[model samples]
Target: MNQNNKVKHPKGLTFLFLSEMWERFGYYLMIGIFTLYLKDVKAGFAMTEAEAADLYGTFIALVFLTPFLGGLIADRYFGYTKSIIIGGLMMGVGYCMMAIHSLPILYLSMTLVIIGNGFFKPNISTLLGNIYSTPEYEDKKDEGYNIFYMGINVGAFICNFFGAALYILLGWGYAFLAAGIGMFLGVGIFLYGMKHYRAFDVKKGMQQGDMSFLKIVMVILFPAVIAGVIGWVVPTQVLGHALIGSPSTDAFIFACIPVIYFYGSLLAKADKSEKRPIAALLTIFAVVILFWAVFKQNGSALNTWADRYTDRHVENPMAAKIFSGLSLSQQLTMAKDSVPLYDEAFRLQKADGKVLQEYNYPTYFKNVAPEKRLAEGTQIEVWATNISQSINPGWVILLTPLIVAFFTWLRKRNQEPTTATKIAFGLLISALSVLVMIGAVYSGGNGAEKVSVFWLMASYGVITIGELFLSPMGLSLVSKLSPVRITSLMMGGWFLATSIGNKLSGVLATLWDTYENKANFFWINFFLLLFSALVAFMLLKWLNGIMREKGIK
Candidate 1:
């Protein structure tokens, strides 16, 4: 290509960015409302917080877990482009099917998404690495990944507003249909750039001694199913109150054992030159689980915090009008006679030791003073709960450029931190973000009152910095360090760690009601990240040494 015609990066990057952007828009839109849908009294399943949290955790965990098989299949049989198209179509159809308001269909829809994500997630990332592998783009690989990461957040940031608008204006079904449309759009965008990625869409066929596809299915998939079944059917009384919080929780943890072993076997069997780097990646993967466990709670525990504890009522008429026009406001009718009573989990607040019978009580006003409360039966508008899902992605959108610029400045000054170092600091910084929530809890009088929405925004801002440091670095590290032949497979391993942490996040959220004092709950999250940070810091020298040996930054 002529110099003027040649792009600074691959033309494929633009296509991949838009494609992934739209895909995430669909995925996040569905996730942003998932728990809310499950817990809605009239329109939803009316599940308790614990029940909803468990299902949400299991759904996200499986969503990330399938990439291992997908990457393996793409590496061995299908190419990246084909797998991406198939996965995208499957997810689109699945999202549409979710519009059917039946429990069986809901589960079936979730299954389709889980399987679809497997085929789509890791391969797209691996393809991006392949495009950047050439000498022309090699030096800019990290920057390329950062830019791509920003695209994901862009989709994530924008989707909630659309989801909120659709849910408010049309209904739940239309909002879900919108997710499906976004996925189909993503697939169309990917196909448009197929020719650009073709040169780099090389598949690694079966290597010598690699297991056959059938054997992998038999050894990994079949055993996982059997183990999950056993975990699910085994009595909670057998273990005395559920071994790991719930049957699904137990099943997922049990299922992961074999997959964890599979990754370990890969390390054990690698040639000497590849062994240490694989080990380093695995070590980092193990530690970062804590970061994800806390971060993923934005969907479950944090969503609850936003719904019941944050001050979401709009006092400014202009702001209310704007939000109303966007279909992002929830109208509450204040009725003193309709106040809800506390459930067993305390999710609903009670008055005068009497259980209230009314449905759709305005629980958001539970903490308000009597003098400030609206007249009985008067209607007031507040922003919807799921809109809070936008905060982290909003931070990502604002701070990513600043973060990239700061690191670039450090690089120019020869003072840039190593990727491993950035991740270590990321863990520590994320731990501190948990402290912001602890402060919020205490400031709000242990959930007895509504706290300022700024607390949630500040917490998200702090954690977004940590996320920028760690998440993209992990992806870049896999690309930089993995054996070229197993790049996609190792990416799968990175996501496997994420999968486990995501499930654990749900497990923790299920316990949200167990803590009478909510500040203690956040303190526990802080300590988990703190411990992980300590471990990462201790291993920093060894990890950097491995990078140096491989001649990478």
Candidate 2:
């Protein structure tokens, strides 16, 4: 029985896995269709590509930002279990509220989700860490987290199918409502397994030399709010135009200033023993910002690629029939409509205040060869674009076990790379992933024709490997290196980097319409990632030395 127990994971892990899976199901389901919903002319807001991408960027940035405060609050006031419950409930309601058509209600719902994520995201992970701190599970903590991460991707992978079916069969509202139901289901699972992790729900209120709750509110939160408001209002009101991609973008960047300062101050005030570790973590955080900036594009720019450029038409009659019966695909007619003519660079052409081409065709057929063009009334069954959002997580689900085995094999031979080494290599490999898109652009004749969905699949496959190497390792590095009292603060720094990177992704995506040569746009991403990898390689020795000082791999 003891030997069997050693081979098996704890019961709590199962519950945590189910809970996180459901929570992600709700979150990713909403994200999968968000921009598409925003751009729908009749049912959605009819936002332009830039407008939708900007909003999507801001929303996701805030979603990551709140976890800083949420984790802090859970540690100081609410315990992990309670905070997770509250956050989950808030998010559940927020998803349901998204079903409402009112703009005001949508904003309100978004705020709830941002705040809820702050509470739920960090606390649950922390609780898991606490559970694994026990002697029996300590050796297997990394395995546990890898398992937990897979649960997140599992939810992410399947939610798109449900979302596509629900939206196709009913409407966007029903799909959003399904997200809310998923969140509630997650909360229920967490509650049912409460006893398993209840012992680890301990909270440490105020500690010696720690700032009081009121002080934190006054110095950090209040200042951030004021700065954000000023950023939102001042740029357009004073300058007559946005200083950034959008007002929300400006606001988020400005709000981050105070928080950035706070983290900086920690480095200044940290003890000699703590100083080097904090600085090392901060340097890493800054470098990985480039990674998130590129990866987060899945929801915006990539979604657009899948929607407008990919060959999603289901050619197999049986497959098309299955998709149609399941409401997983939409049947679109190639009806003629007004579309603008393009110049040599593919920019829209105009003459005397009128579009050059009066014969408008559906956008999906814009790049098809004239000889291959279908009749005006011909109908095609095409898979929903949102389904493409699942590709990364699907890759995650498929590759994780293999990745774990590969790393485990290395560990046994004493040949596993250091965390820093893995991250540096991850960045380099991610840079290579951009070449796939460059290939895709060439294959599609710079958007003059549709390319096979296989290109997107291959790109996602490469990047998922990069993500597996860097993302989990970063989290573990923080736990291994941070001073006990300041660990939470360092964690906040990681999220800050992620939030900033997410916003940058949006900013880059806004330029999608401007780039006549789409390859140029992907090239920019490649360079950014390559630069980050170079920086990581230069710092690798020093970072590894710090790990040695801390006596961790």
RMSD of each: 3.6, 3.4
How close to the true structure is residue 224 of candidate 1, measured as C-alpha lDDT? 80
For candidate 2, write residues 354-461 as lDDT tens digits: 223322222565676555566545667778889999999999989889988998999999999999999999999899898999999999999888999999999999
Error of model 1, residue 447, in angstroms: 1.6
Residues 1-553, candidate 1, lDDT per residue (tens digit)? 3542354878899999999999999999999999988877667776777889999999998898899899889988999889999999999999999889999999999999999988998889889999999878887787788789888989998998999889878878888999999999999999999888888888888886567889878877888888887777775647655688888998888888887888899899899999999999999999999999999999999999998899887788888887774534433453345543322123343453223242544356667644555654555667888889999999998998898899989999999999999999999999999999999999988977788999999999999899989998998898899987677668878888999999999999999978999998899999999999999999999999999999998
Best by lDDT: 2
Off by over 4 Å in 1: 1-11, 129-144, 198-200, 208-210, 235-241, 267-275, 327-358, 483-486
Error of 2 at 4 (Å): 6.8
Error of 2 at 442 (Å): 0.7
- Candidate 2 CA-lDDT value: 0.88
Q: Which stretches of candidate 2 lie over 4 Å from their true place?
A: 1-7, 326-362
